[model samples]
Target chain A: MSEEQNKQTLVAQETITAEVNSSDTIMDVFVRGARKGWKVAIDNIIPNVLMAYVCIKVLNVTGVLAWFGTAFAPVMAIWGLPGQAIMVILGALMSMGGAVGVAMSLFNDGTLNGTHISILMPAIYLLGSKIQYLGRLLGTAGVPGKHYPVLLGISFVNAAIAMFVMKIIAP
Target chain B: MEELKRKAVKVPISGYIALMIALVIFSGLMAKVGGGWTMLDFDTLNGKFGLMKSATASFMGQGGSGARDGFLFALSLAPGVMLALGLMEIVEHYGGLKAAQRLLTPILRPILGIPGICCVALVSSLQSTDAGAGMTKALRENKDITGNELLIFTAFQFTAGGIIGNYLASGSALFSYMTVPISVPLAVMLVMKLFGANMMRLYCKMFVQEEK
Candidate 1:
């Protein structure tokens, strides 16, 4: 390992040790974290679910999602996604793990498959680029600086390029 | 930012067109020029489209009801990650991370060429990529990050983890279909290297002031 990275690693190790010796026990840490996790999930998911409900109520009681699918189809088409995967993209982006729920739902209902999986790939890669407040916490916590605004742009372009190339190369 | 925005606005439209054309050419070549697959039935793209349409129609019909039963599959993992990270955060609050970063800050600054204060977003973005983008924006908003540094740091945030995770972990067929071939990690890393270097260079210009 490079000297710099090694130093960072050592520091991380020492910090953990020091923390354990303090008043907080490991169990205390875990409970706190779980509660925080639940909070983050509840906090983010509610707004999204509400938005989806509102969007569903206002946008297309009968075929709003289908229209959303169609609207996203061309964009998804660019990544080889069919129109139907739009909701899957939406589910995943609204909150963490929501997409997996969407995918699982589709899978059990005999909807998702290998081909659909392919179409969803680029969209997933492109999904949550706007994880807004999370980035600020990282900055405050001393994360490196070059990790936010541009990562999505670079990664998405790369993913788009990669996904397209894969489709072409495969068939 | 005003001047920089104005300069960015001046970039030629033709540049965008050229990029789009290149992408098309590359995609076409990928579609037709590949080997060891079904013997060149390009006209049957309609059949592929048809199959996708039928499958998707079925997928949307009752997918949501099934998903509610299985959301727990995801929750199982979130708790562990959150727990571990929370412990780490508590450790940080106690000043362990402060000592650690301080010890390593000098090297980090020279290598990443970023103010140490910006490292939080940079590192957070590294861990969770866009999960950290919000954090990055918050830092920017709080004025904890310098403008040029913010732009530069954001550029470095997604070398591979973001796209690859999206493609593989997010279970998005859209991403998989688009990315598995062009080498998402490679393309992203290349762009990151180039863009990040450029951002750093821009920040290092004679006019920019250092943080106090």
Candidate 2:
């Protein structure tokens, strides 16, 4: 590990050990969790969401988003969503927060509404962030490289099925 | 692994109650209740920002696009993220997660085709991806699970890995716009995780050969 990361790890270890040894009140625990949440919101969610918004803006300016809608509409229609919903799915492959960003941008643009958001929600996470998880999750678990495709395929199937289920159940 | 097998934490009855409270908060069932019961809901407690100008517009304003718009939008989600995690931390502190692990042990074998020994890693997987992955590696190195079983468990974790954390933290962005309750999508993703794991199990049964 880099020296910086090593230091951070040491500090984190110290914090964990200290916290465990002490009998903290419930409020202290909540504040600690909230602090972690704030870190996540600032470091991960905000940046990804910003990038997604810029990406959608670029797609809109070039009219590529419209073409995507037109092309994917027929397929996306099966789930009762518009053609534009494909961007959300594509964004989800990389990051869950990005997918939400794309979906929210589309919602703001009047391309999708609450029902569409509802329909797309589970699929966003079901296939959420798999591109990164390939290394962090499957690779670390020592899942053989050969089975990667099968695992990926199952996630895709899960996402597709989830959208269908969401369509039926979304009000 | 021998060293890792330490004594289990004692889960008090309060831990189970905290688990139930966690469920009810995220489930959005309490979102519609009247009077003091509304305190139990997520959205109700997260509340809303003051309107900026027009009746329709809030702090984000309207018709804005691009990164600037995204920044404001994300900022709007900050409080919800903080609140969700704060409550999650409280639940976890009171042994809620341990309570969940105990509950999930009996169901893991039937639902995911994995041994009960995986219960700890499985629960951790829902909150943090790296921790779950590291624990799974330990499980494999210790030979607690077979190769096929590892594949199945990894399949379960790979899709929607970090379910609760990601959902409550990142997924909170869409909570306001969702037609259903906040927890419905989470519920769906979890069920689908189970289904995907089973598919992997079926694939192993049919195609992947077992080593002698």
> How well does candidate 1 match the true structure, expressed as C-alpha RMSD?
15.3
RMSD to the true structure for each prediction, in A, is 15.3, 3.0
Docking class of 1: incorrect
Best by TM-score: 2
**TM-score of each prediction:** 0.46, 0.94
- Kindly report which residue stretches of model 1 are placed more than 4 angstroms away from their true locations once superposed: A1-21, A46-61, A67-75, A88-110, A114-171, B1-117, B124-146, B156-212
By lDDT, the best candidate is 2
- Clashing pairs counted in every model: 56, 0
**Model 1 compared with the native: what TM-score?**
0.46
Which window of 10 residues has the lowest lDDT sum in candidate 1 chain B? B41-50
